[model samples]
Target: MDADRVNTHTDARSETIRSATLELAQELGFAKLSIEAVAARAGVGKHTIYRRWPSKGALFLDAVLSSHETILEYPDTGDIVADLREQILAAVELLARPPLDGLFRSLLGEAQQDAAISAALNERFIAPQTQRTIDRLEKARDAGQLSPDLDLELAMSILSGPIYFQFLITAQPLTHDYIDRLLAALFAGLGPRP
Candidate 1:
């Protein structure tokens, strides 16, 4: 086969594998998901998946992250508060829903015991998302919306910490009102000093 056709074929197989991984994860939860099942679902050999991902955790991370790429992006709406609120709301909606919530919870639970999975989760998902939020916060700071000296990393943590707490710890409902109050307190603290 020609190079272009080969590349297309490879890409198609990768996408099929990712889709299969996600479907199986949603249906069986991450604990029960296995390479054999993914291979059967995708119609690809187990070796093919092994070649692409080092482990089931790596494969699951790729599948979930790729499927929800947009949720990780921070919007630039000029109004930093609005942008942050929009992105946070999107994430809350995702985590508060079925399939993904259970899938993600299972993945996180796995990560807690597996060093490689934990590192991959941080590197692939958490770090990138944190950087995106920091970048947006820096832009807002440059625009005078946030204090120039504000610690962008800390700000990013502040925004996400509570949401994760409620979603993953307290098991509280992630309501729009909750997000609004969170943003209100965040901006209230971040706003210009009197």
Candidate 2:
């Protein structure tokens, strides 16, 4: 094969592995996924898997990035509270699913152990999506809705933390009501405490 063909083939093969990783994660989950299973599912050799990703964790992260579930489409409706409420409600709905919630929890644990994986999640997954929400907050501040002194990062953590806490603590049936309750309480104390 020519050099271009070789590179193309490699890229195609890598995508196949990532696709298999997604299916396997849905069925077997991230913690239970294996290179052997991925290779078998992808109809590729173990060497291909080894060449593409250094570990199952890396492969799983790529699969997650490639998966539809990981893609968050947060909207900007000009009304920050309405926008935030919708975004949080969507997140709650997505995460309430069984394998997805389990997969994210597993990913969080794996992220703690793997520096590269954590960096990947933070950069590719979390950072960009987070910037969208933060941008909305910045817009809100600019529009004089949020207090100018509000810390964007801290505001995000406070907003998401309680919902995630509910997911972690009891895996409760999260609803729009819960999202509302969370936003109500957090936003109450976030700004100048009026």
Candidate 3:
């Protein structure tokens, strides 16, 4: 077979495996997912998954992060508050969905006990998303919507932490009113203290 054809075939297979991982993880939850199960679902050998990812956590991280990346567009509408509000609302809506909600709970529970899983979750999912948010904050800073000295990473945490807390810890409903209140509080504190 030609090299380009071979590459395309490989890419297709990788995507299939990732899709299978996402489905299995969503259905079975992260704690219950296994390489054998994923391999069976993907119609690939166990060795194939092992060759791509050394552990179940890594595979789950890849699948979940890739799925999230496809859906989460970086909102840059020039108005920083509107951009952040829209982005946070999208995240709340997405993460609060059925399978994803359970999947996140399972992954986070497992990650706490497994150092490798924790690292993979942070590196693959959390860090990338945070970095993207920071990039947006940087753009806002450049536009004079935010302070140039603002800690962009911390700002991301300030924006997302409450949502995660409500979802995972408080078990509170993330209603539109709650989102508005959250943003209001954040903007009150995070905006320039004139």
Candidate 4:
């Protein structure tokens, strides 16, 4: 096969595998999801999956993250607040829905016990998303929408921390109102000056 044909074939197989993984994960939940099942569903051999991913966790990570790749991206609409709100709302909506919510929770649980999974999750998903948010914040700061001295990393954390806390720790509903309140507080600051 020519290089182009080979690349196309490879991409098709990868997409098939990722789709099967997601379907199986949604049906069986991540705890019961296995590479064997995914291979069978994808009509590919177990070796095919193993060749691409070292472990089930790695494959699961890729499948889940890839499924929501576009939603995870930050928008640049000039109005940083509106752009951030749109992106955050999309993220929260994903987390609030079926399959992704359960899948993400399972991934987080697995990451806590597996160092490889933890590192991969941070490196592949968390770090990149965090950097994207920081890059947007930097633009806002440069444009004078955000305070020039504001630590972008901290700002990113500040924006995400409450959402994660509600999602993972408190199990509260991640409503649009909740996000509005969070953003309001973030931009408004707290208390009277001393």
TM-score of each: 0.88, 0.81, 0.83, 0.90
Off by more than 4 A, model 1: 1-10, 190-194
Clashing pairs in 1: none
lDDT of 4: 0.83
Best by TM-score: 4
Expressed as tens digits, the lDDT of each residue in 1-194 for candidate 3 is: 12221121237887899899888887777768899998999999999877777678767766776667645667778998888888877777677767687787777777888777777766656777888888988988999988678877697678888888888899888898998888788766755677
Error of 1 at 194 (Å): 6.4
Model 4: how far is 120 from its true place, Å? 1.3
lDDT of 1: 0.81
Q: Is candidate 1 or candidate 2 better by TM-score?
A: 1
Residue 46, candidate 3: alpha-carbon lDDT: 93
For all the candidates, what are their Cα RMSDs to the real structure?
A: 5.0, 5.0, 5.2, 4.5
TM-score for candidate 3, residues paired by index: 0.83
lDDT of 4 by residue, 1-194 (tens): 12221121238899999899999999999999999999999999999887777778878887877777678788898998899899999887786667589888888889888877787777777888989999989988899998779887687679999998898889888889999988988887887755
Candidate 3 regions with alpha-carbon error over 4 angstroms = 1-10, 147-149, 190-194
Give me the runs in candidate 2 sitting further than 4 Å from their true place.
1-11, 69-71, 190-194
Query: Best by lDDT, which number?
Result: 4
